[model samples]
Target: MKDINEPSTAPLVIADEPVNSEVIKTTTATAKNSSNKKSAGVSSQMQLLALAKNFVLDGGLVSSDKQMPLEERTQKRARIAALRKQENLEAIIKKSVNYCSATEFTNKADADWFSTFTELAEDVSNTTMQNLWAKILAGEISQPGSFSTKTLKVFRAMSITEAKLLAKACSLAVTEQTKRNIRIISGAYQTPGLLNFFSKNREQNITFSQFSLSYADLLILADNHLVFIQETESNPMNKSESFHFNFNGKPLTLTANKSSCVLKFYKFTPIGSELARLISDNIDDTYLQHLKSALSENFSIIEG
Candidate 1:
């Protein structure tokens, strides 16, 4: 009876120990789970921040998609892309324009006069047409008869056959007197009318010698007399433009005068001959000015 009242000591002891062990295990597991959950939350927040930074760098926004409706987000992305593309295109255009200006043709054969004619033909504005005719009259067109009568008529409402006849007639009209004038200055070939016009009853024996330069040949017509023809790149820098006249078998020193906006020629020493005097004494400044004015009246500046 005493043993029965004592209760089952072994079973109680085993039960109590098992219950305590289970509680301890449960508490440890719960603490580990909580720590893992916190770590995961922090990692997720860091990932979101990184994503947001990347979007901003790429000209976009974080949560932009979620905040805006699907249609609005799509439209916004398209607009941004379009704007970027437009800016790129504009930059390309500006670069191309600058290049064209710097590298345009310098030869008379490849002159801008012909291009003007083509542009006029495409769009026959009265002002443009008149300008084209003026340039032609100023002897700007190097190959007068290169285009067919049909082309000319289509270009200028004139009869093709009639225009061809007129061009031939003009070429034949070149006189011997003009040829003599051009021969005196450069011994180089010249059109008959041009020769006659330059030589017209002048006793002053003008002579020209050609010298090679970086951009174009320099025509030295006696000492103070020089014509510098340079091939300039169409760019604003005008890097292709340079001077070329010989001084003691070397090029003359060139210096730019910022105040006058003109280049000053200096230190020219031709080996054997004295430098030729400049033709300013006999030149008709007024007539030359008028000619330039007339030429400009016909030509219009076209954006490259």
Candidate 2:
């Protein structure tokens, strides 16, 4: 795979409007003086002028005049909106190409899927969001069924904050080695059996807040149907039985030291599983250690 840090040589066809000077001025006001402020203002003006040249129609930037008829002004505004959307689409396409592999894909993206993607992506002007859309496009091209239409709709509705929350959850996510099912290992349940007859049933759960992922964040994910609202438990494992799991890309083998050991977790919905593929694996050493300590009570952890 090519390094993502390597810059692309491709040029953007049209640049968006320069960011407002007021935002920059407000941030740097205390650190800079009057001369610096004047230079910042002049720099912003030059950028705006450069942007105007990119959108020049006939001879000048698409600007409205009160002298023109109402219908003409309305048409001009619509044309400008269309041009802006076009620029957004081009920028996303360019970014997507960077993610595409040199190897050709055997399958092509569906017509309906591509159509829906373009309709939704054209209006996404935020650079961060645009990069996500581009990655979605590239993923679909590489493997047509990697993401479903429903997944796309859910993603389109997600705000940057919600997306970040999901990413945070993914950083601590785990999965069975042989299965693609994703889950958050919140706790474990030790069933009332020969090993724990006196204690009845024992349960151990780690609060997500300790790991910087709060319950409120989980509620948001559940509301979005990315994760099940209720906690799920695995089938009881007999003593000496072993299970393999992948945690943040690392493989682990866990063998039950006691009978009726049930692993408790929050399962990801189908939509969640699909979108989770987009998140790069980010290992949390502290979280992993905590999980190991908890599981050590009933199982032996073997890293692979």
lDDT of each: 0.29, 0.75
Against the hidden reference, what TM-scores do the models get? 0.17, 0.75
Model 2 residue 127 lDDT?
76
Candidate 2 clashes between residue pairs 3 or more apart in a chain or in different chains: none
List model 2 lDDT by residue over 1-304, tens digit each: 1112222334434448654445433423333333223333333433344433334322222223314565665677678879889999999999999999987855867999999888888878767778888889899988898888888899989977788888888988888776579999877767886657677236667778988789899999998989997999889999999878898789978787788888888989999988887788888989888888877777777877
Q: How close is candidate 1 to the true structure, as a TM-score?
A: 0.17
Candidate 2 regions with alpha-carbon error over 4 angstroms: 1-70, 194-201
Q: Which stretches in model 1 have alpha-carbon errors above 4 Å?
A: 1-66, 102-304
Question: How high is the lDDT of residue 303 in model 2?
Answer: 75
